[model samples]
Target: MENTSTTLTMTRRFDVTAEKVFDAWLNPEMMKKWFFTMEPTNKVTKNDPRVGGSWEIVDHREGKDYRAIGEYIEVDPPSKLVFTFKMPQFSDMEDRISVEIKPVENGCEMTFTQIIVIPHEEGWTEGDIEKAHNEYSSQTEQGWYYMFLGLKQLVETGKVKYPS
Candidate 1:
């Protein structure tokens, strides 16, 4: 049995231009401004926005290495990014996680989703898909909620807060 959960979609609407919003995600310097939760706290020490480039991040936690590794399969500046996500201690059931950005009326609409199953070591089984979804729904939603909030604040007001 395998358990799986999907983030379905996390869309954010901003008042800034699509180009600026896009750069917020593609530009390494600009990205570091609001990409993570906030503090510069989690530094994406190594970021390669180009296709096939690898990325790495280190969370200044007690013992957490919040890293993102793997090759970028697709990269369309200010539009789409598809990459495989991995770490030394934990691995996603599905190797890929992708984010698509589209220009909205006055800004950008980002649709983020992940094709993955729960970590096998968590005692997840095939019939636990719904359970997995239910358990992860809140945390996952909150994550994106804060993420968009952080991005919105930074882009609109030049403010950033990490781990909020």
Candidate 2:
């Protein structure tokens, strides 16, 4: 397998305690409200939050199911989380996501990183590879930004209002 990759990092501050913010990530109910907004709704089929535990989110839309699966690599309550993320359609690749929540006055700062490993296709030029990598990073950044906005709204108002 050819090796081509990109890392997307985002930082956000939420007006909530570190524990609260961190809980929102691992809690299945809370994740259902903010994670993966591309679809209309989702079901958290499995949410075992611990080292080696697995989680699966199934997006339900148009009478179809789109699922994403992951395994927890590390879990430090109220502080840090690391996981291996994968989508079945891209079975050849697995990505690693890390989240660090630091306590700050009036709230917390969350640093999120996702390292995506893109398959290097044969016969692709350097320019083609760069373009594809940039596009993937941009889309991932936008998607997570919106999800974080949803998370912020939910944490502040106790309701889900994803940004448009």
Candidate 3:
């Protein structure tokens, strides 16, 4: 069976320096404030911000822990980052995410992209693949939208006013 993939890209402008925006993605303390859609009761972030390094974030919400693990494919400070992302509880499939930041007139503009690969099984139709792609794309986009809002608030105001 052949595998299918979908790519989704989102861009947001931040009223902060490029370095600040980029650091928010790799800094453990910054991530704890703006990474998730809902604030986790407890969170642990371990990051090695270099090419070939690994990173993990485990958020404890309610009584369960959700883990996000990945390896750094590329890490260029204040400009670009590329990493693999996976949640063991969700699926075995791993996705690729890339973040690019550029200086604008006032602050910076960030473009984020996620590539999701779907494994195809026997007897799966085109419609089935399309449905899976659409569902994942929509959910991921929405999740990032909220996370970006939180990141913006934290970087611009020194506090996360909008948790979600």
Candidate topping lDDT: 3
Cα lDDT tens digits for candidate 1, 1-164: 44444655666778777667666766666555555434545666567778888766555556565665567788887778887765555555445667777787877777777654554335545566566676666665675677778788778887776553
lDDT of each: 0.65, 0.85, 0.86
Q: Name the better of 1 and 3 by lDDT.
A: 3
Candidate closer to the true structure by TM-score (higher is better), 1 or 2: 2
User: What is the alpha-carbon lDDT for the whole of candidate 1?
Assistant: 0.65
- Which ranges in model 2 have alpha carbons more than 4 Å from their true place? 37-40, 162-164
- TM-score per prediction, in order, is 0.77, 0.92, 0.92
Error of 2 at 114 (Å): 0.6
Worst 10 residues of 3 by lDDT: 34-43
lDDT of 3 by residue, 14-108 (tens): 99999999999988888887775234553678889899998888888768898888999999889999999999897788999999999999999
Model 2, span 31-102: residue lDDT tens: 888777333477555689999999888887678777888899999989999999888965757899999999
Error of 1 at 131 (Å): 1.2
Spell out the clash pairs found in candidate 3. Answer: none
